[model samples]
Target chain A: MTDDKDHYIRALFDISPAYDDAPVFQQKVMMGLTLKSWLRQGLVVISGLIGGLYALTQFVRMPEWSLKGGGLYTGSLQMATRRTDATVEAGVEFIDIMARGLADSLFAVGGYVQWMQTPQFFWVSFALCSCILVLYLLNDAQERI
Target chain B: MPQSPGHNSAQDQSDIDLIGRAVTGSHTAFGELVRRHSGALRTHLRRMGAQSSDADDIAQETFMAAFERLSEFRFEGPFIAWLKMIASRRYLKKLKAAQKYLFTDDATLFETPDEAPPPDMRLHDLDSALLQLKPIERVCVTLNFSAGLSHVDVAAETGLPLGTVKSHIKRGLDQLKSALTVPNSSSHPIASSQNGAAGSATPTFMDERR
Candidate 1:
């Protein structure tokens, strides 16, 4: 008899009301997931930008200090303004000199750039970008559906 | 349970497949899951005495939390069961925060006994029948019957003493039987006896002795 009562109660509980708000509920949950995804992606992108900027500054500073012995900043500024001629020939020559100096700096920093391309850094960057891209595509696909 | 409109289209995909997709950041898969189970979960929460708005809020929180921790979910059980567990815990947490105690001798708990809805009104549906029970009793009964949790599991999940959980379930079942079965029906002798034993008083743990 007790078993019967239990069964009856279970049966009663099983009778779910016809809830028609599932679409609305699903929309709310999906909206929540979208918001969370965007927030997470935003954090990742912001952190990556900050880290990349810091690393770039460090890379640029290290090479300048090592190659030029701390005179690169003032020296470049003086060189660029030293030939302030109104003639187009002088301006062209000044730009040519600046471009050559930039090339020299790039060559000086070649070792550091190669180090950044090593397997460890390359793989880490690849994996991070891949994750972000996959997340973005998934979110976009879900939104479209 | 009534399926959402798109439930059929997603029915071809297994829950594990959907979960795998969701884990990889598939919102469409997760949305399908939400569509498939939200009705039953919402109904379960309502049976447990959660107001409609509270049920929706708790259900939303449960799904959001489940999404955040989808990787932690083991594949040993049905996905709906996992969803129900999440929703139940969310509802219980909300209830605990509001009421502080799951079981109490507060007079409000007994108010329904004296002001019992008419028999016809109570028999209108199982939800109405459940509403006749105290909050604790309703939770215990719903967890046991609706969520299909064992007594031990319900006690553990509720953080209530096992004995208290059992008594609440028994009393709750008795009240529900009395409310649901046609009054004075000879075929259901147990229901009739339970009604007599229960009387028109606020249920108390003390009454469990009888």
Candidate 2:
């Protein structure tokens, strides 16, 4: 009885109306595909343009010491090494001051504040923010695609 | 009436070749696939209790998804089966999104009139017969019989309990049999006793593995 019922049901569902709208259906699907492709491509191009514009802005704002070569490069490297040593010293001093107590750490805190105001710090912060923004935009665009 | 350009050429290529081209981003090849399978898929969705407009929408969404995921197709089965699987999943998603609580375990919620008079067999098609069933029952039966999903697969697909899926299938099958079975008519023979034929109404691409 189960087998007979299954057979009858299969045959019944098999009797589908002959639809002549295949061409129209195909056109609709193709149009959807094309539109999605265009949107995805447009997103990628927009993301690339945003990234390019950000890079160009950063390039325009870049310090001459970072972009130049020869004497200025050597001087900048030396200056960067000195600044790194000074930052390390300040960090150690801040930790030591924290270990002692918070009251005597004004000079260390001032040194850290001065370090944060430097051009190198500003460039680093700008680059990090730009990278994060680009990555976020790319991720959003990929999810949309 | 003249056929579209490259229509004959596209038809000559096998589904595998068309899939390969579609994977490489050939809209024409993918369009051929859509042209080939849209009718059957739309019909399957309609049998699964989707309105004709909704069926077409779901079919279009399925094809679009298939195109995006063409590379994931392993070529281990018929392309039509893969397409149907996507369509079934899409339809289920739409059903769930539209009706948040459609697939409950309550049998009483899906009860049909068992003692109702049989319809005029001449005018009674499967679509109308399917309407006699509850939405969940129609979905379960169509997934099992039309979309070639097993009871467990249907349960997994619909997120319903196994017992509920089984009951739905059983009740849906009973209702369909009562509605469609011709009294003392021998015109319809059991087409094929195998799982492949029993799984699908129109046996275009029978994936026995399903």
Candidate 2 positional error at B49, Å: 1.9
Candidate 2 deviant stretches above 4 angstroms: A61-145, B1-5, B105-118, B122-124, B182-210
**Model 2 score (lDDT):** 0.69
TM-score (chain B only), all candidates: 0.75, 0.77
Residue-wise C-alpha lDDT for candidate 2, range B106-189, written one tens digit per residue: 668766676664556434456657878888888889888777788899999999889988988898777776776544444564
- Alpha-carbon TM-score of each model against the true structure: 0.65, 0.67
Give stretches of model 1 more than 4 Å off.
A60-145, B1-9, B99-101, B105-109, B122-124, B182-210
lDDT of each: 0.71, 0.69
Q: After aligning candidate 1 to the native by TM-score, how far in Å is the CA of A54 from where it should be?
A: 2.7
Candidate 1 structure quality by residue, lDDT tens digits, B133-190: 8888989999998788999999998988999899999998888877776444224222
The candidate that wins on DockQ is 1
Tell the DockQ for candidate 1: 0.19
Best by lDDT: 1
